[model samples]
Target: MWEETSAVDKYGASPTGESFEPGRQRQVCTRYKRKGKRHRRQTGGATRTVMALDSLPSRVVLLYDEWLKLADPRTEDWPLMASPIAQTLIVIAYIYFVTTLGPRLMENRKPFDLKNTMVVYNFSIVGFSIYMIYEYLMSGWANGYSYGCDLVDYSSNPLAVRMAWTCWLYYFSKFIEMLDTIFFVLRKKTSQVTFLHVFHHSIMPFTWWFGVKFSAGGMGTFHAMLNCCVHVLMYSYYAVCAMGPAYQKYLWWKKYMTTIQLVQFVMVTVHIGQFIFMKDCPYKFPVLLYIVGLYGLIFLVLFLNFWYHAYTKGKRLPKVAQKSKALQNGNGVHHSNGVAKEATNGIFYGTTNKVANGFHHGNGIHNKEK
Candidate 1:
């Protein structure tokens, strides 16, 4: 039953008729003033914007002032609090071994047919994504999120702890997903193991560990949720493809998969971009938002590059094919209207044959020799 007016004006009392101590009221009021002053300083002279709640829905502002104000994520008893560094080193070693050593090891040996294993692995990831989506909705969005400046809940409250656990589970899933490139090497689909692929799989968990460590839930979790949704689609595609040849028809729309990926990055970038423009969010960790936003942009650019090569440049003849074509043409390859064609036809070349044997036997030309 808190009111928006209470945020700035009625700080000396609560809705339940409890009176705040005069000294406590003064301290809280001073903090509010300092927040405004800091906003004005950091926002590049939008003093009017110093009162950030004015731009937000009153209900949301009230929610922030009442229940969300009690969040405390700094307790020392969190799980997996000690293993991040070791896990990161393991990830680094995994990357090095996969890109360099694994490919070499795979070079001489026959590629293993991991078709059945891949089907199982990819679908399991899809199921994990489904669980994450449910956890995110239940623990964060279901709580009536402002979707604006929602901050993490650090309390031992059951729902809050659930959100934290979901965040960690999402992080751990990325580690499991590193097997993507390992599978590629095993199958000798080494061509599929590109820089963009490894960087995406490896760096994701490494950076997300920080998200789980500090702010496990909030506006920040939105992209994580969206990414999990996209992974559901992505891994499902891989699973279907691994079911042998019968499923190939189902993959006719595979060309649009990269389009879908680009869209995901765009969504993430926009979601995180809100933190930069908003005058104030309930969240204090502005740096985390910047990191998330930059991560979105970086991946967006990398995926665009992949799409350009995979679709645009991929349409052309490969290097060896183009070389053979140029050799056959003699004068060089010719391109017109995006289609390659031979520069010369054979009828003209036969004009220099001295009309002998009717310009070569079996050509069906008639010339009498006396």
Candidate 2:
């Protein structure tokens, strides 16, 4: 019976003895299971997962549009809140607690195992950035808006929830950046926290808050793109450095990191200025320009001062040493020519050989190679 079963279906088998399952039948459909048809689910967070483009419900899109209008009401109708002074103080206090107090508590603690943490963090942020980059690219070609528009109206699109989630993550990163200082404060590497250090830490998160708050137009994206790229390199450098001394020399790009930061500000200022000047595009302009302009000027001044103090002074110190070296090479010793000539001329012939010997002795060049 078992042998016969191999040769027959419920009805019968082909003459060649080919058989099929009794419940099975031939189907000619060419389509394979589509990628998202099953087991596809929301990811990232509740707001992000359910509201994703793949499974976005119509109601969510409507709600998102409503939210965008609320978030970015027309320029004239914005309700006045606290004065800038009050708001600024509140924001500064908030940063002091989040960036400073938290880090101080963790001071004297061993550096966190940044390797594993950074790996997970980078992978997630990089994936999120890639998603946004793709969204921007497609939106540019097919959706009519370019990079800036994508960012400004980002909250209104179907995928706005995901962008919001990622934007929040980037905002939180500024807080994480405070750890750069904590490591300084803790490790007793106080020299690292120069004025540039505190200024960068203190200002950036606030800049981002206003950026997201005001809808900062689309021109703000150059800031995001440059930041993402810098973080990619910066965190990777940190990850490698955490491994050991092997990476110290490999970090020659540290110099370039500062350069990149300066360049990022320049581009940001120019982009914001263009929006302010042109008075074009989907999002508001002059508002972002004013905010970015102030921030950019602060950064420019602080960073240029830092560059001068760190590198310019550094270069000058070496040049000073080189000049000293040249002077030493000109004379065998550091003694003045007058002292040498007086001593030698008074003691010796006061002529050709005496002067020559005096000069050689003064220069500290014992050898006759010169």
Highest lDDT against the true fold, candidate: 1
Each candidate structure's TM-score, on Cα atoms with residue i matched to residue i, is: 0.63, 0.48
Best-performing candidate as measured by TM-score:
1
Off by over 4 Å in 2: 1-144, 147-151, 154-156, 159-165, 194-196, 279-282, 305-314, 318-370
Model 1 TM: 0.63
| Candidate 2 structure quality by residue, lDDT tens digits, 269-342 | 66656665554455554466577666766665655654564457642223333445556546532322111211
TM-score of 2: 0.48
Model 1: residue 81 alpha-carbon error in angstroms: 2.5
Whole-model lDDT, candidate 2?
0.45
lDDT of 1 by residue, 32-75 (tens): 67777676577765645656657668867677556433333442
User: Which 10 consecutive positions of candidate 1 have the poorest summed lDDT?
Assistant: 361-370
